[model samples]
Target: METKKCTSRQSHFAKKRYILYDVNPLEGFNLRRDVYVRIATFLKRLNAEDKQYQWILVLPPWGPLYHWQSNHIGSQIQLKWGMFFDIESLRKYIPVMEMHEFISDYPVNNGKTTIDIIYQLRNDKNMYETGIFKEKNMIVSCSNGPVSYKIIHDQQYTGFFWGYSNISSYDLQCLIFHGTILNLKNNFNPNLYRSIMFDHMEIPLHYTYGSTEYWEARRSMRYNSILYNIAYNFTSKYINLMEHMDLICDLKNNQGKNLSQKPPQTPVTHGFDLTVNGIAFIVNFLDHFTETYLVIIDAHTKWPKVLNLKKIMEAYGLLEKFKCLLARYDSPIHVVTDGGPQLSSASSLSIEASSSCV
Candidate 1:
């Protein structure tokens, strides 16, 4: 049999061919020769159509080598190679795409389901000027659920094991402050957004136990400090300096107990007791701000008759008084009714200047 010379056209399309030798002839009979022949035939068809393709041939552990070439004369080619007995060993060469067709059906936007992109951005260490619109918009457009464990585990480990655990609660409190600053900086400074994210991060931690317990515990321990620092630095650089002490005070007072318990009780002027609705309103106000002011206009008399301040001072002195009482252990002063109206100017000045003294 004469070996035909290779042509330039054949060489142009068949750039590379990979061949594998098997040690076991029996296995080789099943996989190497048969699979390689099929692949070669497929490549030949593609080449005939002027399409370029790569071919990989797998050889059994041991084999009588079979040759295939367009120019080769007789088909009786055979040569001894090596041996292969382990079926598991064959696994490495198998095409992984055949394992599951569902993987191919995954949505195009499924990459967001993994943590890869988020962590990549985070690891870049460049401070991003991200707004709520961008973050929320990305989340809405994403086809996947929250980030997967594979994506966040590395950052979690790094944040936990790497001395970040040692960060103080006060610093974490600072971060909360900065988050406010950032919110204002973004021009859509909604406290609700931060509140929701914090709640989302916390509720799960509260229930997690055992192995997950450690993760939650570590997260809880570091969450405030890390978030505070991030928020503070980001806000300070990009937004206005926020008055976050009031917010912090509110969170601390409401965590497990009543605001009144934390602060001194003040006497209601005009000797009038508050209705349940009024009390509820006051509590709700405290939940958002440390102070509130109330001007009790007598509905029957059709005139503003009484002024009450919370602890902190603002136009709404009632709410401010409430905040101040929470912050400091001041004696609650009761106002006694005097029909004489001897010092009306003095009373107005005192109410107006309450915040100034603080």
Candidate 2:
């Protein structure tokens, strides 16, 4: 009974640790989205372990991505994650909160929140040069190369934390990491830190590609309804425009000459009863085993003509039926076929004698 009381007490004291992550500054929006799946999978594994502390994933904010170059949408810097993703959908797979929510929940110092630790991940150079890859995770000094985070005078390291000035980190460790995301589990020290951020988090690949966890994480990343509505509106407008226009216009230059180009006119030159301007022909054999029928349709008027054939249909019989159709109406300018054997075996002379087979 005393041991059970101790275990219950420990369970009651379990803390909630937040995992924050960011991709490289050079990475585009789509790649960053993939990184989310990696981190979510890692968090799911961490929680499945039933550790003493509950793990929560802090969603990184969207920002001035190079691919988001649309000038019409105004500045895209420091956009909230909720602007593009459904927060509730994401929570169904893993516990996730936006940057603002994290800030609100975190204790601030002098109007700023200092993350407990930040890991600047770098790819192992030897792996690329030697053409041999192996799992590696080591704490080392920041390389002389262009590092994104800088140590300020206050001993606090600062960088473009999604353009948030109030976020800083005191314990910044440079890690040479090359492996799947599960390998990063070694860095978690729940007793020492509550919030940990990983810069260049995209360096690590998925823990288990195409696994059940991966698919669940992928499905959880639902786009916001606003984006869906925008896409629906744009698609509907474009389809409606295509009904009357055939050419694509430069959206930037709405008044350009390309937008003024006329749509191609239809080739029909005669009224419904005057001439057969176009023809489409097919053969029906499904209903009867002893008889074959040739079907010819006027492309313009949709008028159909069915001619019955004897036990067998030959090229000569097909030509004679076509000639009869021409004799009833003006010779069609174009003739089409389903490429049935009767049509395929017909001599070019016989078909051309009626009309051009197109």
Candidate 3:
């Protein structure tokens, strides 16, 4: 745990990744001591290994804070909510790798920026600088995306509850801020890093997962003002269209109608026929930027499972997923499809399942 020894041991042999993980914020929700103990034990394993690539968890500065009076203390319930690493053990990592160490080394006047180690190193090279912090390229947020919940959490404006809860992404921003604060002993320009962390609180829109339209400029001024309004509109319209059996039964005094009181008397058909289909969408991966996701949906229960595919609806890949579904769930007598080239009846999966495609 000596700072100098840890730093000396930090030399990279291959491309090293600093996987900053968000600690599970809700560890003690059930008021169990065993959960907290397990979380601490689990986190301790991060520094237990030495590898070319590694994961480092940045925990928030968690400590006790009292409201009204010091005597009237907050409960343990308030303590477990923040997602940062446990504050107590965090100091050991100060010399290990600090947040300020990852601060974008770009010039001060340009604007706030995330750590782009290679670009800034090249920028230094432009100035005729050499051997300037020579090390492997460092990429922040290796485990997750740059768009974090804390980055979009708005804190300045006040409401009735008015920041009392701090239930928003406050912990995430604090986690990043502490990353810089912990490494103050070696920060090039602490003030610049502070400003960079400030950007997380200013914007309040979640980053679009699949699209890279705005990653170039972290946030657009126009979208920051009212994009949430559009998001609110879309979120409000999603409702359960299925008939509420409980509500109907309550109104009818249980006279009838558990499920569509009018049953199909003629035949036992589609209910026994469970069909699966998928739509491809873009998703970001750990190593690659994005890949096609084949999201399979059960027509009856509306349950969904996703499979990552290399190409758009590749037949062999589709067959693999179809076989997986058949093994997991009841075998449909016949699988219906729009006869797309990928999910066609001629595919080996239909033959395997003895399923005739429509």
Q: How much lDDT does each candidate structure score?
A: 0.24, 0.65, 0.27
Q: Please give the ranking of all candidate structures by lDDT, highest first, separated by commas.
A: 2, 3, 1
Say which prediction, candidate 1 or candidate 3, comes out ahead on TM-score. 3
Model 2 / residue 19 / CA error / Å: 0.9
Q: lDDT for model 3, on a 0 to 1 scale?
A: 0.27
Q: Write the per-residue lDDT of candidate 1 for residues 1-358, one digit (tens) a residue.
A: 0111112112343333222211222232444333333333332333344323332233212212342333455432222121122222122222111111212221112121110111100111122444322221112211233221131322321121111132111001101112211121222112211110110111111112223322222221111223333443554456632221111111111122222221123223222222210111112122326645343332111233223344544446554554454333232222222333322221322322244435
Give TM per candidate.
0.15, 0.62, 0.20
> How well is each residue in 54-144 modelled by candidate 2, as lDDT tens digits?
8999988887887777979788887888898868768877899989999998766668887878988998998989999999999987764
C-alpha displacement of 19 in model 3, angstroms? 3.9
In the range 1-358, model 3's lDDT, one tens digit per residue, is 1342223234334233332222233322222222223222332343354232333332222223232234455442223222322222232322123333332321222233222111111112322355443222232442333332333322221111111232221122221222211121232222222211222211112223223322211111111112333432343355332221110000110112221111223121211211111111111212235666655543222334466666646676666655655544333332322222222222333325424221
- Cα RMSD (Å) between model 2 and the true structure? 18.1
| Model 1 Cα shift for residue 292 (angstroms) | 6.7
Off by over 4 Å in 3: 1-18, 21-51, 56-324, 328-358
Query: What is the lDDT for 15 in model 3?
Result: 31
Predicted structure 1: lDDT: 0.24
Poorest 10 consecutive residues by lDDT, candidate 2: 269-278
Q: Judge candidate 3 at residue 215 and give its lDDT.
A: 22
User: Model 2: clashing residue pairs?
Assistant: none
